[model samples]
Target chain A: GAGVSQTPSNKVTEKGKYVELRCDPISGHTALYWYRQSLGQGPEFLIYFQGTGAADDSGLPNDRFFAVRPEGSVSTLKIQRTERGDSAVYLCASSPDRVNEQFFGPGTRLTVL
Target chain B: AQSVTQLDSHVSVSEGTPVLLRCNYSSSYSPSLFWYVQHPNKGLQLLLKYTSAATLVKGINGFEAEFKKSETSFHLTKPSAHMSDAAEYFCVVRLERGGNQFYFGTGTSLTVIP
Candidate 1:
């Protein structure tokens, strides 16, 4: 079976530009999560989705960051006016249910030039 | 608040020798603990998890961990180190309450030398 997958493994953009990262969770996985991993540090939670709604967005750094999971499967993380601080590996994970072991994706490395 | 601490930033071991990675955690409630490994340019792979069922939990690749409520520790260990075991390991603690938030440690990089 296919695990969680993310598109555009690498993305490079200007600091002031906007970018969107995509995540495809495992089949039938109702819960999804997003995390950011900086160099030499563990991953930090960003956002989480349960079905079509954003269950928890408290981990998002600021208002410029937003995420959507319209269909309850695919999710998109949108960052407006990207800054150098936003450069990191964006990781996505999915679980069959809440509070269970999650399956992670390879991650999309975003670099702000 | 829930937090996790990995005692060692890096560990080096010779092949065929024992390997140990220490981790300690603090949480208000009964939390779930997990260990994950990440190779360079790869996603995190779950090594094992403790869900309050058993104190000793075994995971893939001959890895195991003992969950100690008294000491608030869940350290990963293996009987023998292999070259393939060299990678970065992360200790995670998840709070079941408040949307089940997850906290990760700084991570420990393991180096297995032959």
Candidate 2:
């Protein structure tokens, strides 16, 4: 079975531009999560989805960052007016249940210039 | 607040030698602890997890970790180090009451010299 996957393995964009990163969770996974890994640091929680609705989004840095998981399978992390500070590896993960271990994706490296 | 702390930023060992990666966690409630390995340009792979079951947990590639409530630690260990084990390792903690958000440690880079 195919594991979780992220599209556009690498993306370089100018600052202040809008960027969207997509994630495809494993089949039958009901809980999805998004994380950002800065250079030399660990991944920080971004947002989480249970089914089609976001159950927790407190990890989102600011209002410019938003995510949606329509249909409960595919998710997209949208960054408006991207900043250079936003440059990092965007990782997505999914689990069968909320308390289970999550399987992670290869991640999309977004670089804001 | 639930958080993890990896004691070392980097560790190097010779092949066939023992490997140890230390991690300590802080949480208000009984937490779920996990160890994940990340190779270059690859996704994070689960090494093992401790969910209040048996204290000694074994995982893939001959890796294991012991959850110690007394020490507040869940350190990863292996009897023999393999060259293929070189990578970044992360320790994670998740509280039972929270909304399934995982708190991660900075990470420890392991290097195996053949």
Q: Write out fnat for all predictions, comma-separated.
A: 0.79, 0.89
lDDT of 2 by residue, A1-113 (tens): 99999999999999999999999999999999999999999999999999999999999999999999989999999999999999999999999999989999999999999
User: What is every candidate's C-alpha DockQ against the true complex, given to 2 decimals?
Assistant: 0.86, 0.92
TM-score of model number 1: 0.98
State the lDDT at A82 in candidate 2.
95
Model 2 Cα displacement at A26 (Å)?
0.3
- Model 1: CA > 4 A from native: none
lDDT of 2 by residue, B45-106 (tens): 99999999999999999999999998999999999999999999999999776587899999
RMSD of each: 0.8, 0.9
User: Model 1 chain A, poorest ten-residue lDDT window?
Assistant: A95-104
Q: How high is the CA lDDT of each candidate model?
A: 0.95, 0.96
Give the alpha carbon lDDT tens digit for every residue of B11-108 in model 1: 99999999999999998789899999999988999999998899999999999999999999999999999999999999999987767568899999
Query: Each candidate's chain B TM-score?
Result: 0.97, 0.96
Clash pairs, candidate 2, are none
A4-106 in candidate 1: lDDT tens per residue? 9998899999999999999999999999999999999999999889999999899999999999999999999999999999999999999999878989999
Candidate 2 Cα deviation (angstroms), residue A40: 0.6
